[model samples]
Target: MKVRAYGKLNLTLDVLGRRPDGYHLLDTVMQSISVWDELDIQTSRQPGVHLQCNKDRLPTDSKNTVYRAAKFFLEDCGLADQGVYIFIKKYIPSRSGMGGGSADAAAALRGLNEMFKTGLTTEQLMAIGARVGADVPFCVMGGAARCTGVGANVEPVAPLPDCWLVVCKPPAGMSTPRAYSILDQYPLSSTQATPRMLEALEAGNLKRVAKCLGNRFDETIRLAPVRALKRAMVDAGALGSMMTGSGSSVYGIFVSEDQAREALETIDSMGRTFLAQPCSGI
Candidate 1:
């Protein structure tokens, strides 16, 4: 089975609090984006997972989310004796906070379930995926959702208003763990971003949606290049701009593709940029 793993953007991300297990509770609106990675999977007579990725730096062992997804799915389905092979053609940049890894893992689970005819429902896949990563459930469901509680609780919402997005990533990558550690050291700036974002989405107001774009990471860790990229997007006619995920990648929402393309050119020199739009859930 072949599956596509679409990337995601954070229209609003807030850290509600930390749990006793040290997991930070989150209340955020996540949207699927046109950016994606593709995976080809098939069952093998061998009794272990085999993974091949286009990116050499990516791990292919148990540490790899793709491998873990396969292992866990097989074990869950009483097919642990079965083996699978997966080849990932990656387009999404890693550590961009775009849920690339989680998307890939979700895709792997979807493909494996189909390959083995496991008959697992979407909810079942999501439950298994949560063990792999918090963003996995949302990615499995696709479209737009308001996710909370370590990202395991996903509430599907109205799709984002049709718009173009200029997504740019600086060369500096962010470590999610390190960012969370740093974020804990300081107080937050705003906690209402999710509610405002939900209101904007429900109204289908692109401008309001853009204005509601906010990330707690942006307020807590003001990376120099990230701020610059956000400015460039606004200067090039974006409705509003903000950093997505933890730190590195920033996106600007635009009402039209032409505006987004122009903004892309404006930021072309500043970082690795892409012209993207909102994507529906699987």
Candidate 2:
């Protein structure tokens, strides 16, 4: 079985508060993009899960979410005797706030279910995914969504208008834990951009959507490369641009593919750049 693990962008992220358990409360809009990694799975007579990735730096053992996801799914379905080998063709950059790892884990859950003939519903898969990572549920239920409660509570929403997305990631990666730690030092605010962004999305007005593009992390993490990338996107005629999720990767919404391609050329040398579109559905 083969699955495409798509990357995601946070159209609007608001840190509501912190939970007693230490997970930050989040109300955000998440959208999958065309940029993705691929996962291939095959049944193995061996009674254990195995994983391999194109990226040598990533762990292929139990530490990997993909491996854990397979184990979780099998155990949940009472099919531990079933074994599978997972191979990942990685494209999405790690630690770019792009949900690359989460997406891969989601793919494992999906692919294993299909390969093993485990008739698990989408909700069931997402429930299993949530246990692995907060973002896994959203990746399982792809496309546009309003995610809350540590990003596992996903509510599908109206899709964004078809527009080109220019995603750029700097060489430096930002750790999510570190980003949240920095955010803790700052005072919380009642102001939120998610509500306005949701309204704009429902209205299908790209201009309003652009105006409401925001990420709370932007106010916290100050990096010269991220700032430069955002500016370059705007100068290249993007309707709007913002850093997705915590840090590092920044994306711009462009009305025209031609314009987005032109923008990609301008920033290609700055960092890894990908031209993508909003994924329409799961």
Candidate 3:
């Protein structure tokens, strides 16, 4: 079976607090973008997970998150007796505030569940995913959500307004580990994105939602050139704009798809751009 693993962007990410376990408590609103990676999985007569990457950018070994996800699922289901070969075709940009790797891992779990008839419940799948990475659980269960408790506790929320997104990625990639380290050095800013955007969403007010969108990490990440790209989008008449995850990639929301395409054209003149709509559901 084959699956398309959709990438995500955080329209509103607020670090609520830090946990005793060194993980940061979060109140984030994340939506999958149209950007995705293609995964092909088939049963193998062999006894271990084997991975192949068509994209040169990603690793084709156990170190890769997709391999680890396959390993985790097979072991958890006592299907270690079985094996599968995964062929990955990457399209989403890595380490650019997009959940490329996480999405791939999530897709693997979903694919294996269907192909192997594992019968693992959603909660069980999420639990296994959490052991792999913080973002894995959410990707396994897509759609808009309010994530807390180191991003594992997910509360399904109403779908976000349909808006076009223009994303710009700079040449430099921001490491998540390094971003968290710098976060500790700075004083705690406001964890305001969730509450404000939640109100807008409940009201189904697109204008208000656009106006209220924010990310706390932007306060620190704005020093990079990607910020300039966001500013440029605003100059081109974006309804609202912000950096998605950690840093190095920024996006602007527009009222119409046409406007978004125009904004993308502006970015394409200078840098890479992804034009996509808000994902409605999984």
TM-score of each: 0.98, 0.98, 0.95
Task: Specify the highest-lDDT model's number.
Answer: 2
Off by over 4 Å in 2: none
Question: What lDDT is reached at residue 247 by model 3?
Answer: 73
What does candidate 2's lDDT look like per residue over 69-119, in tens digits?
Answer: 999998989988977888999999988989999999998888887887889
Per-residue CA lDDT of model 1 for 72-128, tens digit only, reads 998889988988889999998987988889999999988888888889999999999
Q: Candidate 3's residue-wise lDDT over 69-133, tens digit each?
A: 99989998888999899999988887788888888998898899999887887778788888878
lDDT of 2: 0.91
Per the 3 Å backbone cut-off, how many clashing residue pairs does candidate 2 have? 0
Model 3: lDDT of residue 12: 88
What's the CA RMSD of model 3 in angstroms?
1.4
Deviating ranges (above 4 Å) for candidate 1: none
Model 3 TM-score is: 0.95
Q: What ranges in model 3 sit over 4 Å off?
A: none
Which residue pairs collide in model 3, if any? none
- The candidate that wins on TM-score is 2
Better of 2 and 3 by lDDT: 2
